[model samples]
Target: MPRHRQSLQLTRLKKAGIRSAAMLTLLTGVSGGLYLADNKADQEAASAEALFAEQELTEASVNGWSQHNVLERKVKAEQEAAIAAAAAAEEARKKAASTTSRKSRPGVTVKIPASCNEYSGNRAIGCALLLEAGFTLSDMANCLEPLWTKESGWNHTSSNGGSGAYGIPQALPGSKMAAYGDDWKTNPATQVKWGLSYIKSRYGTPCNAWATFQSKGWY
Candidate 1:
């Protein structure tokens, strides 16, 4: 081998080494730039995804609040309705009690005279007849006494010109008592007997008849 040829070959080899180093540096720089751009793109995409997720979360929270508010309103309405219904029922009960009080009459206490014979003519006859009609002396004092006193004062011949009601029980037209006797117009005993029968059939008792009379002014 010649010395010059060997020196030329070494120079050529050094030049090739420098070219390879330059090429490696250029490739490394390009790869680094591509990596940085890809990283930036990935960061932007992650930021966008985070923003979308945050927006969805905010919307869900708003919807949840809206549903909760609706539920709260429904519960409040139901509670108010229940309170109103209870108040109405109480008012109705009070009104019913007041009406019942108005419809019923209070009881009265009365004192009886000692004997049927202690009364006057017609009064004594009425007292004796009342006792014979399966009624107590208390019934006469509390019911029959006041009842006949208000009707016809125990007079068999007593007549109402306006209504044609007559006799001790004030039978309308006075002929209704003929079922007991033809002498119902004049005989006090017959009128009393017919009156007692009518009271028993219609009202069951003299006290019941008196209560009806008190309530409606008629029996």
Candidate 2:
């Protein structure tokens, strides 16, 4: 009874110990597999996060560059517009100045008539007009002769075709002598009075008027 029972109990104990060791090994292997799977998942998540960050940075940089380009283009366009406006304004100002200058005083050209001739009546009229104006005709009679001869040949009705000048003094439009008398167009005395006054005001004397006429061909 003792030997058989003892042998059976020993065998049962050995079988129990072997079963426990197998269970522990299986649990250890499962735990190691679980740990490896968890570590791989964590690494994948970290890589995905890094990739997302890189994409965001790239997009932001592209946006910033696009904005800079737009701003630069806008500035360049504004500068070009301003330059064009300034140029236009300058051109307008120059045109206005030119128009004003032309409108203020117009230049006149001189012309002589083929029928012009010396008339003795002019000398008489010039002498009387000079005496009335408090000037001595004897001192300025020589200069007056040549001046009137070249201008109107002492003819009160003398007229210029190019400059529209008329009268003994060749007054432009002939009507300018009307300041002396309403008969300036036909009266030799009136024309002579205006002519003498013009010489006094412009050249101070008939000799000076003659000198200016000789130098410039006009006075």
Candidate 3:
């Protein structure tokens, strides 16, 4: 009776040990599978975070480039405007200078008429001297006025370098007028007196001298 009872207890103990080992193996496998799944989820979350950070950096670089381009364009535009303003100012200055040059010369603006009475400055002095020298008004207006105007424009300082002529009557070797007065070179009255005397001696009349000048371009 004792031998049979001991053998049955041993068999029960062996069956219990086998069931415990199987339960432990199942638990280990389930735990390992859960750990692997958790690790995969964490890796996916990290990849998403990295991609978002990279996208943010790219957008920031693009915005910075756009801002730089805008600033560059603004500077270029300002430079162009400054250059245009300088060119316009220079052109205006040149125009003002030309206007001033034209205004300064009174002879260039006043045209001499056939009527000697309307004359001013050097021409008026010549007219008075011609009347005093016994020349008729008709001779003075039609011949002497046109002749002197053509030769020297009544400018006492006028000279022709090629012909060696000078003053109101286009006197050749102008020093010849010094016979009339010491100030012949600068005084319109002295030049007028010398010119009238020369016409009386050589051509006899202003009309005759004018006729010669018209035909030959000189008298």
Per-prediction backbone clash count: 0, 0, 0
Write down the worst ten-residue block by lDDT for model 1: 103-112
Over 8-50, each residue of candidate 1 has an lDDT whose tens digit, in order, gives: 9999999999999999999999999999999999999999999
TM-score of each: 0.46, 0.46, 0.47
> Tens-digit lDDT track for model 2 on 1-219?
699999999999999999999999999999998999999999999999999999999999999999999999999999999999999999999999976764453222112222222324557556655656666655345788788889888877888989999988998778787666666777787777778889999999888999999999988
Pairs of residues at least 3 apart in sequence or in different chains that clash in candidate 2: none
Per-candidate local distance difference test: 0.83, 0.78, 0.84
TM-score of 3: 0.47
After TM-score superposition, the amount by which residue 81's alpha carbon in candidate 3 deviates from its true location, in angstroms, is 91
Report the Cα lDDT for residue 181, model 3: 65
Clashing pairs in 1: none
In candidate 1, stretches whose alpha carbon ends up further than 4 angstroms from where it belongs are: 1-114
